[model samples]
Target: MAISEPASDQRRAFVLDLPQRLVCLLDGASASHGRASLLLVVVALVAFLPGFFQISPIDRDEARFAQATKQMVESGNFVEIRFHTQARNKKPVGIHWLQAASVTAGEAVIGPSALTSIWLYRLPSLLAAVGAVLLTYWTALVFLSRRGALLAGLLMASCVLLGVEARLAKTDAVLLLTIIACFGALARAYVRPRAERTGDFRLAFIFWTAMAAGILVKGPMTPLFVGLAIVALAVVERSGSVLRPLRPLVGLVWCLLLVLPWFVAIWFATKGAFYQHAVGVDMLGKVTEGQEGHWGPPGTYFLAVWGTFWPSVVLAAMAAPFAWRARRDEKVRFLLCWLVPTWLLFEIAATKLPHYVLPLYPALAILGVMAIERGALARAGSRLAGLVWLWPVLAILVSLGLGGAYLWFGSGFGLAAWPLLALAIALLWMAARAFPRVGPEGAVLTAIAGALVLYTAVYQAMLPQMRALWISERLAAVVKEQGCPAANVSSFPYQEPSLVFLVGTDINYVLPNEAAALMKKGGCSLAFMDERFTGNFEKHAAAHGLKYHAVATISGFVYNGGRLTAITVYRSDDAPAGSGAAR
Candidate 1:
């Protein structure tokens, strides 16, 4: 009852032909830089925009970054960094300045109400992610065929980590764009012969300027990634000749010129506390041990890349043989030098975040496509043939995992996601079946079809519907619906940065007794008392003679504590005891 071999072969050919045509179409498009660049921008937007406007402010990092930016917008303070009364001394002011500019532009063009829209804060990240894709293509062009470069950009546009970074208002996405810009210029200069490398001033400007921008965004990281690559290449080739093209001495002074003003300003502003915290504590502490519980052993990124890099990660694995054989090639060695040393350093570092190695992903995508170009990819009977299943199998597993999350946390199966889910899986299955005829390169293009669809489903459909996971959003909505949008709230036990961001800056993070005291003073006062503090709140309320009761209860998972939390919001309309003043 099985299908005939000829019939199956025909089916495989039809499936393979589509990806083949896609590859050809991109190659033709690459003939026109405008056409290719526009295509990459479109791809990046499609990959990044599905949940950009819909998802709530993520806690810990994204919300903290956004709130600090908001404070900058309000206070008109461009240099000093703060989160409420506490100084956010960890990072430089570049991102906050960019985010402030974004919010200001939104308010000016879109309306004053744009100040509160979370998407406005994330606009920089989305644009930066798109810029990184284009830069990836530009960087790959120095070594790869135009088609291969386009493919690399497409892979970056479709990556899981980039998409995540694009949606959040943080430094990583912007940092990524700068890093790739550095790579684009450095890769160009590195692959040339030492004798011909007379240091083009333009390339040096781009490299050092990009490095400066990276420093302003995140201290030390840009130099660390770029410097490590420079050092590694010098050590590997046993010569400092390659460094000539970058014009090291003059470029260093130019880089310092761009960054020193801010460093000097911040030093004077914080009395040197900024460097002590940003360098001595935040940076080094992360190297020695995990800060904020983001700890992982070595090789964590190797496993995380399967999901983080998605479709192209499988192809990158398939390209290992080619990478080994071509390790000595000028371009290949440059890429490996760019990728390996920093990667190993991060692996050795005690602090490990998934995005820590994101700047290196462009190298992986280029290598994968290079393998495909050289016909070194997996064939039907090849040793890497088993990896043909990795893409499709991972696609299915990740889809099921996300769909399960939607069902488990959202109180029901996400019915709206059914069509998209089926489409994604069906395309992946087709890609898997075509592997024998099309090979890894074509198969990656086909698998990306599924990945793009899955991204849409996960972000636009499933993630937005998981309301319980976004507790701060619910709290904000309830307060607004109760006609107290500007109510002063005292939140206890569940003081996530997202709550501080969504509810307002004035909200006090306090214990039950203090929350009760705050509510006793005036009208339009609110308290989000955790269930654990219910008794204490009631005791304090009785003592203060404050007539307040829980209007609504919110239940959700708190990411920081990794536990389910239940908080009851208490509202009050009482005036002060003696004044009888109505609010």
Candidate 2:
């Protein structure tokens, strides 16, 4: 009986230990999951919050897209998109469709005036930005550990180019989303091949479908990037057999089906005018001869842009050798394939823009994270620590110098921005003090975040006050007071489409030759002209027998040099006897 009693007590002890062990494991798993979820939420908030204050008005190509989408919605023509009285079929129909759909949905939910809402147009981009964050997180997880994924997300969310593009109503964000999605799917196909084997064809089909979506959103560059990366990865791994499951015929069929209808409709509707411009000029000529106004030096343009766009991540790029060393590791291999090929391709392109290289940013973020994880940044600690201390001392001296300069040269130096400068100094001091204790990684992140915050507070917060002091938002109100038809208003040399968008009018551009014809057609008009163009504009206006009276002038300062410029409005001398020919 004593032996049995002892055995029973031992069994009870083992059972008690089992439950406690299970509880510990469960608690650990929960903590990890919670941390990951919190990190993702923080990333999303960081990406979205800054845009709330920044207004992206119709500018350049954005104007073209907004005008086209507006026209399409009004015309109820889903297939063909038009802008500035011309069929613009160069870009695929995907973006226009998205805009139109948003406008429709917004109108239904928010009532009319939806078409004119910038937020409606910007909604898709905002959603795409969120998608980009989620995709970056998932992609990093696929190639790397949880910590790696968190770092990648942090890098991507902090990137300025991604932040800027995500705020604008453009195709780039959507293209990025699709590109990341396709790559994520490809990663899944590679990592979990056994699971994909049953539905391997379907998985490949979906991946290619995303590629097609990307192509439709941007152009051939989408497929080009995806294909190059995949092929390069396969070659590097010496595993062409991995690509055998991809169904080229099904992908082609899907792409043709998705893209053909719009192309055919555009061809018929424009009576082949679309073909000449879309195929011959916009698509083919852009690649061959380059666009008329937009051109760049062949090499290093992309590199410079990448450096500026994501300065923090670009700093990590110096650690590429460590990244290369880890190339045999699957995660590193994936990142290399994702980053290197796209970067090389863009670097080689003749036509380059800062935004064109946006697709490569996520891959670079991943690379940057990998580089950091591999201890590639440890070599810079001595220098980094020195800078952390040196930076604050230098900043304080610079701040004093700037204060002296401002006092000597100017008046009314407000204390509003001073607080930010002070805060920056404090952050620098704190970072310097914390460096030895927190280590290089924490110190670097702190410094980067401090710099970003200082920039945001100055540029975003201070600039608005300076702008308001210079340009009159009251111009729209004054124009309305003049009884000028909003549609009849025009600007010479340059166009302020923001005014047109706000006033719900078709703002006409008056070149030197057309000003006379336009004046004669519309007897009286309101116009705004930049002072820089005043000399040639006055000569042209005098030649056309037009009289003008200046109404209001607003002087605004440019931040770069604090130079002041004036925007002046004038009423036309000759009011058109009747409505001038439609602009």
lDDT for each candidate structure: 0.85, 0.63
Q: Give the C-alpha lDDT of model 1.
A: 0.85
The runs of at least 3 residues in candidate 1 whose Cα sits more than 4 Å from the true structure, single-residue gaps closed, are 1-10, 378-381, 485-487, 575-583
Which digits, one per residue and each the tens of the lDDT, describe model 2 over residues 1-583? 4445587667555434433443343234335646655665565555455534444354556656766787778778887777654567678788888888998999998876787677788777778877787787777777666766665666666666676666677798888888888777777767655435334676677677888788777767678778888888888878754454565667678878877777778778778886687778786765665475456666665556534444344445555666767778776787778777777766666556677767777777777666666666665455434544653664576557655544443335646657866876766565555555544445445544555555454434443344333232345555656667756666654444444454444657666446544654555577666677666666777887777766766555433234556666766866533222100
Work out how many backbone clashes candidate 2 has: 7
* Model 1 agreement with the true structure over 1-583: per-residue lDDT tens digits: 8766797677767787877876677767788888889899988898899989999999889999999998888888788898966999999999988999899989988886676689999999999999999999999998888888888999999999999999999999999999999889888887787789887899999999999999999988998998899899889889987767888899999999999998999999999999999989999999999988889999998889988988778788888788999898888899999999999999999998999999999999999888888878743156776776776788778877877778778746778787898888888887777777766656677888788898898899889889889999988877666655444678888888888788777778888889898888877778888889888899999999989766788888886788888888888856222211111
Q: Which one is best on TM-score?
A: 1
Question: Model 2: clashing residue pairs?
Answer: 521-580, 522-576, 523-574, 523-575, 523-576, 524-575, 524-576
lDDT of model 2 at residue 9?
A: 69
lDDT of 2 at 393: 68
